[model samples]
Target: MKFSLIFLLLALTSCSKKEAESERTAHSEPAWDASFFSPKTGEILSYRETIESISPQKNLPISPDQIRKRVLKRRQVYDGSELIEGKTLHRYSIYHDGSFTEGFLFHWVNGFLYVVGSFTEDQKITFANPPIPIAHLNMIAGTYWHWPPQAPAGSGSRHIGLEQITVPAGTFDAYKVSIRKNTQGKITLREYWFAPKIGIVKEQNRIYSSGHLRVINTIELSDRSTSDTSDTSEEAPSEST
Candidate 1:
């Protein structure tokens, strides 16, 4: 009888060891796609790539500088009645040197999504105090704001995906983005519409699910500064024969 009891204890010990090994393996291995979260583990992972390296399947080639310019231009306050299901206002703010801040405030309500920056200086703030519009929310969608996966000097790229999309203007490329969390403990998902020549003309973000998107503010290009008059004034006059 004593020998049988010892055998049972040994069997229990073996099972416990196996269970511990399985748990360790689960935590060590990487995820499958890295875009979706692991429901079992509750951990999120995402792929990495630079904004300029992200290429469309069958669209015109766009350079990193061009993409950066387009991102700046799209950052501004927008007033739209159609997209928001009501009147809404979006504010996009960009500094002289290309630093960006985007804020969205709704007219009838109090809720806002503030995108404080990008890969260069990317931050997001969402609050229910004021409502930021949807058009502005779309601009910062996808690759516009880079969080998580940051590099050595607080810079990183976003990995995006494109699904089915249709718009009033025409059929174009639509993209979705998944941000891998940086050391800052932040993550975001976004969607975008890129027109062939105009670049990323529209975007949308579903941030925080509190009925408010921190980055979905609207803007008009007229609200942003796109040129420098100093260079033009310094140009030498050409004497014609």
Candidate 2:
């Protein structure tokens, strides 16, 4: 009887120790580094974009003739930084064919990269409520997170896995992440390939309407330059109307 009692005590102690270790592991901070996406102040990244309208319909805003097989050049410049809601966010000015299109503000916080806000044509800043989470710095395959915090199931971003991709710029072992959003009857899926210290190497956006595929737009890194010289070239022809 004494031996059985002692055995029971040993078993209980082992279980308690395991439970404590599991709790600690669950609450521990994840390993991540925001520098993986930190770009220099003067960094300039150029990309080649291909926009295709797979199944163009009359109701579609873009006509069938607007679909272009040719690739267009786009540029993004890390021009400045700002302090928003106590967070330091970097501003990226997006240009298409030398014309200013828009700007995005990004920042890292609590092991996550977020799109804190965006800039308008007049350089006005509009912040996102609760800031949209872009990627988890320490994400691994099967890791998942969602924006708006209370979004429904399956409406979120997931780390697909690591993939070796080749673009016009070069080949890189990038982490593939997928973000899905469903609104009304429309569904949009955006996939991003990020290379360490190089930011987004490729992006593909697929939009569907009423359960049918409609458009697929892809942007791949074609060239990157960190030259401090100011851009003064004339605007190139626009790729899309």
The residue pairs found clashing in candidate 2 are none
Model 1 agreement with the true structure over 75-170: per-residue lDDT tens digits: 332222111222222223333223344433323222212232221233243444322122222333344333222343333334344443433223
lDDT of 2 by residue, 79-170 (tens): 75555444567789998888999899987667777888889878688887878777666769998877778776788888998788888777
Lowest-lDDT window of 10 residues in candidate 1?
41-50
Off by over 4 Å in 1: 1-164, 180-186, 209-241
The C-alpha TM-scores of every prediction are 0.23, 0.74
Residue 231 miss distance in model 1 (angstroms): 32
Q: What TM-score would candidate 1 get against the native? A: 0.23
Candidate 1 lDDT score at position 187: 33
